[model samples]
Target: MSALAEKADSPLKKKPPSWSDIWLKNTKPLKHVVFTMPLQSLSPKDPKSQTLIPTFANIDRTLLLSDELLLQILPKLPHLQRNPNSLVCKRWLNLQGRLIRSLKILDWDFLESGRLFTRFPNLTHVDLLNGCLLSPRDSGILLTHRLVSMQMGSGFCSNRKFLEEDLLPVEVVDKGLQALANGCPNLRRLVVINASELGLLTVAEECLTLQELELHKCNDNVLRGIAACENLQIVKLVANVDGLYSSSVTDIGLTILAQGCKRLVRLELSGCEGSFDGIKAIGQCCLMLEELTICDHKMDDGWLAGLSYCENLKTLKLLSCKRIDRSPGRDEYLGFCPALERLHLQKCQLRSKKSVRALFRVCEAVREIVIQDCWGLDNDMFRFASVCRRVKLLSLEGCSLLTTEGLEAVILSWQDLENLIVVSCKNINESGISPALATLFSILKELRWRPDVKSLLASSLVGTGMGKKGGRFFKRT
Candidate 1:
């Protein structure tokens, strides 16, 4: 064999390191450089001359990428980490501003000076609560503005006069509203406190696309401005939420809202006092209305009869209500809502057997029923629900007074039931599950059963301004 061939066959000889191995072992860090096109023209006459030199510029790598590319990359990072990138340069700051669609105003000056618009030009949703709820710097408290406000009012027990003192002056909020109107013409949603009629009018004129609005301290006079919003669809009127504000939005405001905003799809009345006439007007005027919510309502007796007017209402939610109706009148006169598909009762007082039965009668056609954390809902009281024959879904939570027999009896009457959820019912133990109920459960398409789940003790604290508000969770306008 040749000498080279003999050496190749030698097992004792050490092999040389591969190029990948050498590259992997190198610990020196790499420096990234962005190359740009030449800006200066070359000297043709002295092309080879040493006197004329070529210069390479060091530039920001981010500038080379288009705004479209940067936007795609920035969103992949968490918002907390992504914030630092905006401080890098003016380009990044502007790009980051474009990404923000919602903002909560704490400083009224921020909105009044036009800085809000210049900074967040694309904002579609804005909350002016913090601005209106601002407290004097001299107050000297460690708690946040909202927490301080809540404590001052003593939770939901605060009277109207106390809340009035906490709110900002009307004119100050009006200036900020005007600024918001001029800048955010595409604004779709807004949450504001104590805005005057003129301020709201300005917003209505400018923000023609406004759809959802949550108004605090709303009154009959202020609703006149809102009526001008032709595209307004969803509205939450807070006339006198216990610890929040004091002014009342009565039947007059409801009538004005119903007549002017005929395109409304969803409406919420909180701490409002209205009778049958106002509700009848709403049902007659807002033909597109599909959902209606009444929280801590102060409507007079016999108002429950007015629900029959809402022919298109598909969902009726009663939250933290003390009573359905003091006097719903004769069962024949208390007509039912024909299109209602879902009836939701949470943290409500369902003690009066007559009112409870009337409520069940009004929602007789409901396909789904949810009863959660309601007081005075015993087996006898729940028997009233048997009138709802079309119920296909039933969920019961935090109903400590409800026994297994009560639920089983009501569900057995609902032959069309497909889904059942029973959770956190202290009285509904495993031993209470009857043979018939087990058979019915086996046939259900979906069932979530946890009868031993300790009833939520805090459910009773709802509407007391103790827990997080639902509006903050919704990201979409």
Candidate 2:
């Protein structure tokens, strides 16, 4: 053997250090070494400058090889262009489709041509707001069953042909709506405003899976077609008819709808001239009704009293429905619905405080009460809040008669008030709200008021207005 080979094979006189001893000696420099290599490699490499290639070239290859890691890092990269991450690679283009579930086609020309749905096959929900759904030249695009919910404007399926003078041709409206209804088989919810007679008929016959339907400015034909939906749970109708014309909806249309929909839970009728007989029909027929909103010109105390028989009603909203001046008989009849939880009466001239008190006494489970623009609600009605302790939210906006004393009395009675809004109330000053604030300070989550610093000091009793230097208000930051 040569001299170098003999020296390498010879055993050491002193004991050599183990792996742990070597690791302990190199630990401090390892962080600096590991960090500097990446920094040096990240600098721009120039082949003409004779810069040597990194020994860790394989490490860079290993880090960039993972598709999952690339996907996770692409979103974090800063760019000056529009969605540069989307333009990164084909993998990102595939991910964009999975992120979108609902698509609303607003462009009239694009929707009328039916090219949008063809591109996005995964779309299950579609909204055609102020746009027409055009008929397909080929049957393949119309027969793709994907859409489940749709909302459109009125005249969506009318058959009238367009003339040269018309901007929006009649052919577009007829073909678009017909194609949409016939295409989307799984559709369950349909909302249409200003619907034509033919459009109403088409939706009722074609949309078998529809559960909720809303009709605005509709005629008797629409109401009759809505009655045909067996699975309908909610139906809202806003009638727009001339004063000279009227429909059978006051009695016959309502009767047919109530009998047809056994599962009906919510029904809203606004701007309709329905009589007391119509109200009576609803109470008797809609046994499963949970919510009812009625707004009309002639709704009086007698019409409201007729709703007492509706035992399952939990929510009722009556707008501009006044009580008759001499309808003393209907006062006692108001205390019928015991299961009601929410009641909203706006612009209603409630006759007396006794009538308001009678309502609370009957609906003992009421949690929310809103009375806006109401005349004749005196101090006596404010006292009723004390008796009904279950109220969680209360709003009295534009009730000009509600004084500070009246507000204090109501607040003193409430033990579990969470939200209280008193707007446009001129009489409810800081002094009137101080006591209620003290009682509800800990429990109250939201309180809205517009008061000056002097009023705040007066209400807080920090500046001798109420003869106290400091109180709970000082500690409530």
What does candidate 2 score in Cα RMSD to the true structure? Answer: 14.3
Which residue runs does candidate 2 get wrong by more than 4 Å? Answer: 1-129, 132-175, 196-198, 241-249, 283-288, 295-301, 319-329, 345-364, 372-389, 411-419, 433-477
Q: TM-scores across all candidates?
A: 0.79, 0.58
Question: What C-alpha lDDT do the candidate models reach, one value each?
Answer: 0.81, 0.59
The alpha-carbon root-mean-square deviation between model 1 and the true structure, to one decimal in Å, is 15.8
CA shift of 238, model 2, Å:
1.8
lDDT leader: 1
Colliding residue pairs in candidate 2:
133-176, 154-194
Best candidate, TM-score:
1
Candidate 1 local lDDT, 1-477, one digit each (tens): 699887887886858899888766763531111122132333355656543233324446677899999988888988797789889889889989989998988777888888888899999999987677655555444334322243332233434555567778999888888889889999999999889899999999999999999998889999999999879999998887664456777779889999999999999998889888889889989999999999989898888888899999999999999988878899989899999999999999999998899999999999999999999999999999999999998999889999877887888888998888777777876556666766676567666666664432134223323222221100111
Give, for candidate 2, the lowest lDDT window spanning 10 residues.
Answer: 141-150
Model 2, residue 438: displacement in angstroms?
5.3
